[model samples]
Target chain A: MVTLNNFRKHYKDFDLNISMQIPAGTVTGLIGRNGAGKSTTIKAILGLINPDEGEVCVFDKNPREFTPRDKEAIGTVIGGNLLGDFITAEDTIAILRKMYADFDEPYFRAQCKALELPLEKPFKDLSNGMKARLRVLIAISHKARLLVLDEPTAGMDVIARSEILDLLREYLAQDGERSVLISSHISSDIEGFCDDVYLIERGEIVLHEDTDTILGQYGVLKLSENEFRDVERQYIVACKKEAYGYACLTKEKQYFVDNYPGIIVENGSLDSTIILMLGGR
Target chain B: MRGVLEKDFRSYRKTVLLTLALVVLYAAFCCLMPGFDLVHSVLFVGWMGAVAAVNEVADDERNGYAFLMTLPVDARSYVLAKLVYVTTVQVHFWILARVTLLVGTLLDGKKPDIPALLSKGLALHFGMVALLMLILTFVIKFGVKSILYLAGGLVMLVCVFCVLVVTKPDANWVDALLRIGRFPHIGIYATAAAIIATAGLTRLAVHFMRNKEF
Candidate 1:
């Protein structure tokens, strides 16, 4: 549903240049650290920023060329409000109902109530968790075909984060054709949700693998220096120095488990993959 | 555009209400208070329009200007909606101003020439209100801080208009509008020019907003 061909944005100290795609009917996660260009990529896809070079296409058309009808299918939550702090959540829902043709008012109000959001409170008065919940609610309230979410769970407690993810899970379950591109600095936030994961570091994609492979097949082999020399090096995706031995990141977790009985193989997560890849040789 | 207009109307309803109260109170002042006349009241109405438009634009930016841009509405339609809302409110206030003036003159035991007064107010405000609305496009682009600078420049212009109002009211630029009404041939030309200018400025505002990053 979204494609970026050599998309590049130039800044004084940071340059974002990457090629990526999110097919329809898939939840793709763009995981990266803060200031790692995740938001920039999402902005380019949403036409919030013009690419300094290359093309960004959504629904097979340049976002800038998208008509109002074209945009109705997209729902985005990029850590911003609909109106300023002056309007209440009720006012926001009213505005959204006017803004979107397919806005499900009953579903939205029910979700708001389920989430314990105060309907009449101004947005500025809402707590951080409430504000976050409200943003996600607005995104899913409309029956959008594509959701481009940038850091939807940035600052929240574990329960709040879980609640936000549950909202997305519920949204995804409602429609098979609906797609999402959720970016975040927290690996665990998108780890269990996304179908495939894209690990970005310093505006570069270090790895792109399905969530199944990352969780089931990938592993980190902790071995002593002498044992590392004896172990197969071909499957290692990344290697890092450690106090006791070496930590090797490999996509073929079962391969090492079958061969190297002495090397400790731990199931790989996005967090370990990022750590090993970025800090490893 | 309807969505954007409705959203703006509801979001900025408070500002509109305050503007309504101010317009009513000012109209009464023009009738009962010494030294408060049509010229002063018209300028004040124009200024109040600026306040309402600027306040709404500021609130939009402070909250989620970027969020609004992500909506189905294109930049052009969004800008057009804002322009329409500002002008519509200003027009309503303007009509109230003229009605108040008419009643005030009639109630004070003066034989008011209703048609002439109405036409004269129309001729004066068409250009005045349009000018203020166009200037307001700057607030939408640069945020509310720009309003202080814009108001400063406008206050200087208002000062000049006040000088003209006292010394050469018949010879001032406002009189040019009255003269255009006297000559229907010139009225068409002036109107076409005004329409072209408003459209051009609105287009320019959209262009500035098209690539804006949230």
Candidate 2:
């Protein structure tokens, strides 16, 4: 649903150069450390910031050229304040109903009730978790075909996060053609929810893999210096030298396990996998 | 565009209402006081419109301009909506000023100079609208903080000019201003100039906003 081709944006201290695609009917996760250009990429895709070079296409149309009707199919939940502090949930709903022709007022109110959000309270008075829920609710309540969520789960409690994840799952199930591009600092949420994941470091996408393949096939092989030297170099996606020896990330876990029985091979979690990939040797 | 206007109106409902009330009270006071001048009373409408315009811009900036940009509306539409809102406020104040002046004249049991009242009112209205358009252009280009500083500097300059005029009433610049004020068709010309300037500044503001990021 979204394609970014050789996108480049230059900041005073940082330069973002990235290229990626978010296919329809899948949850794509963009994982990166802080200042790794995740939000910058999101901004570029949304046309909130102009890229120095390259192209971004959403639903086969340039974001800058999108009319209000074109934008009606896209819902966005950005980090930080999305509305004035004095605006209440009721006010937001009222305003959105006028802004969007397909805005589902009943669904929005129902979601707010389900989330126990006080409709009359100003946004500033709400807790961070409540704010997060409200933002996500608004995004989904617009009958959007594509949901672009930037750190939607940040500042939420465990229960709230789980509820939000469930909501996303339900939303995807409701429409087979719907897609989502979510960026979050919480790796486990991405691991559990994403169909595909992109690992960005210093404004560059270093890795892109299917979540299932990463979970099932990827492994970390810990070895002594001699064993590391003997191991085939092609299987090591990335390696980090440790106090004892070296930790190598490999996609051919079974090959390593079956061939090198003496080496310690463990199933790699998303956090450890990213650490190994981003942690320069 | 309607959505944008509705949001602004709701957000500034209290401020707009209070400003209208204050302007009305001040107009009444001007009419009742000894040596009351309808022309001076009408000038208050301009000041009130200026205050309302500045407050609206300040509130929008303070609230979440970046967030508003993320909405479905385009930048041009956003700028147009703001202009419409300000114009609506100015028009409402203009009507009030005219009505109050008319009622005040009838109450005083004197023949009202309808043409003079209209000329004065039109001049002030157009001038205020022009000033507001310029301010909006600056605010859009340079942001609220820079505009606030500019406004402060202008106020200081105006104060100094007033003091100079009071101290040297016969100075060359002061005499020139007095002569311009006494020009037979000055009001109509001033009004026309202000209207033209307002249109030009509004176009400039729209162009600046189109290029602005966030």
Candidate 3:
């Protein structure tokens, strides 16, 4: 279990006050716009940066308490270059084998083969998608108890993306209690694999719920200006008034669907749902 | 720690090979050149430390190799590994130089100011090594380029001081250093021990570095 308790960090332009719990044995998607504190939150949990307030515990252990052995339990690929670009993939594996007690050479090699990443090539020489795959492969090969990946598919083509997702799903299915936290800007990728999604806007978690619950419960309700004036405003999260009248985000889609027979209500995609929930006003 | 250390060494194979080549080339000069200075060992050791420390510090972070710093490896272990690497190279070159100089002296069938030069050289080398170890530790902790600029500034400052030292005919720098020579009989042994002890101080430096966050 990964618990983020009232985690707060402040910058001159932004403040991140987020709290969330990620259950074990499930893939939790951290969905946010760029600079929405997703990477900052991840960096805090990884101990790359210290938080101003709040605590993070991964598997009941504070990240600050992380020893080499404790770190071996977590595998991660962040947005920035994680490996030294000069090292060949083969050299990287050899070094990782020494750092991780559970590093399986055969598994790493298999992943490389599956991904078709040349072992002898320097990391700088690999294409961005290939590098992303290699990073995932290396992290996964450690047999980590927790996998934290940030934008693992950002540069991947459809074929490579599917293969990577397939590998992640396979890894998740092999064990009943493994956990993963993935952050991506592409809503479709998150919608494809994540059972739950945490939507962050301007450093705050605007919505945290199971993927189906959000997609099923919240929707865009379009209505005429005169019609919206008569409807109760309490249930409308935010409304955009236009020439056609008003398009509002309703917290309870079913209620609007049942109450406003004449209003236009439609199921929203993850991207629009996030946009409505975050930047609706 | 060992894992990261191995990784650091493996990544710098080219640099290591180059340093070794320099050491060999200098050792050859000591053996073949007339008026051969046994200070060859000291010079080689200093060159090794400078090359290894500067190269590692300057390139690692810029190349984005430091992403591994987030892993469970202690920052100090990372720093210590560099110190250990530099010291190891330094000691190897020192021993090789000493052995070569000893062989050259035996073949010449004469004691050629080896005792005096060795004694003074050892003291200066060890003192410089102690200071270099500390400097490199902080360099690894802070940004490397920042350290390089600082080092460059320091070198320019030292160059001015060297000019002063050289121009001052009244300045008895050699005499001042050699005053600590108590027993001329064991001078060679004492010098050897000083060089070895300088290598030992790196352990203290490594301990300090292991606890750092960078």
Candidate 4:
């Protein structure tokens, strides 16, 4: 649904160089630490800011050139405070209904009602979790073909997060072609909800693979100093010294299991993978 | 554009109400005060319109302009909507000011100087439109925070120019202003010029907004 080709943007303290594709009918998660260019990449894709070089295409057209009709196919939930303090939920719905021809007002109201959001309360008066839910509700209620969510579940409790994830699952299930690109710091959410994941560090894409591959085929092998020295180097993608010994990330989990019978191997997770890949060697 | 205008209206509802109340109070004051000149009231109305425009711009900034950009509207449309809203509010205030002046004059049992009223009202209206357009351009170019510095700098510049004019040995500039006011056609010409200038400024604002990074 969206593609970034050699996208480059330079800031005073950092430079973002990213290339990725978010295919249709799949949930793609972008995981990165703060200042890792996640938001910058999203901004460039949204045409909120122009990149110094390269191109971003959404639905085969540059976002900078998107007409209102083209934009109606995309929805977004950006992080931080969005609505003004004076605007209430009712006012938001009224405004959005006029802005989007396909805006599903009933769906939005139903979602808000289900979430127990006060329709008359000003946005500033809502709790952080409520605000997050409201953003998600608005994004999904527009009947958009793609939903670009940045930290959509941030500040929400476990129950709220679970509910939102379920809502996204249902939303995708309703249409085979709908897609989502979500960026969040919470690895568990990405692991649980995403079909594919991209690990970004210092504006560079370190890894992009299917979630199943990361969880099943990739692994971390725990070894003592002596054992680590004897282990084959070809299987290790990244390694980090630990308090007990060392942990090495391996893409070929079967090779490690078959060759090293006594080695301790644990299933790879997004968090552990990021730590080994981004942490100092 | 309608969405944008509606958002602004709801956001500024309180301020609009406050402005209306102030206009009513000022009109009442004008009716009671002996030898009350409507020119000062016209200027006050102009200031009120400017205040509304500035407040709307500030509110949009504070409300997260980035969020607005994410909507299914382009930057040009956003800028145009703001221009339309500000112009509508200014026109509304102008009508209110005219009605107040006329009612006050009638209540005071005075034969209103129709020509003088038109001359001052038209001048004030033109000035307000120019001021609003300039402000909109600045807001689009530099964001809302710059408005304070811009307004302060403009006030200082105007003050310096006024001082220079008052201290000048020649009275020609003052005489020229008086002479222009005497010609009723000058009001129509100034109105036409103000409209043209506002249209040009709106186009400039749209250009600035198109290049602006959220």
**Winner by TM-score:** 4
- TM-scores of the candidates are 0.88, 0.92, 0.85, 0.94
Predicted complexes: DockQ each:
0.55, 0.53, 0.43, 0.64
lDDT of 2 by residue, B90-186 (tens): 7877888888788778778889888766656677777877887788788888887877778899999999988989999989988897689888888
Q: Which ten residues in a row have the lowest lDDT in candidate 2 chain A?
A: A78-87
Clashing pairs in 4: none
True contacts kept of each: 0.72, 0.45, 0.44, 0.63
- On the 0 to 100 scale, the lDDT of residue B133 in model 3 is 62
Evaluate residue B205 in candidate 1 and report its C-alpha lDDT on the 0 to 100 scale: 75
Please give the lDDT score at residue A133 for candidate 2.
Answer: 95
Please give me the DockQ of candidate 1 compared with the native complex: 0.55
RMSD vs true structure, all candidates: 3.8, 2.5, 4.0, 2.1
| Residue A258 lDDT, candidate 3, scale 0-100 | 86
lDDT per residue (tens digit) for residues B102-132 in model 1: 7667666678887656654453344543554
B50-83 per-residue lDDT for model 3 (tens digits): 6654565445556543357556676556656666
Q: What TM-score does chain B alone reach in each candidate, compared with the true chain B?
A: 0.73, 0.90, 0.66, 0.86
Tell me, by DockQ, which candidate is best: 4
Colliding pairs, model 3: B76-B209, B76-B210
Tell me the lDDT of model 2 at B134: 80
Cα lDDT tens digits for candidate 1, A37-135: 898888889988888899999999999888988989999888776567667778877788778899999998999889999999988898888888888
**Candidate 3 DockQ category?**
acceptable
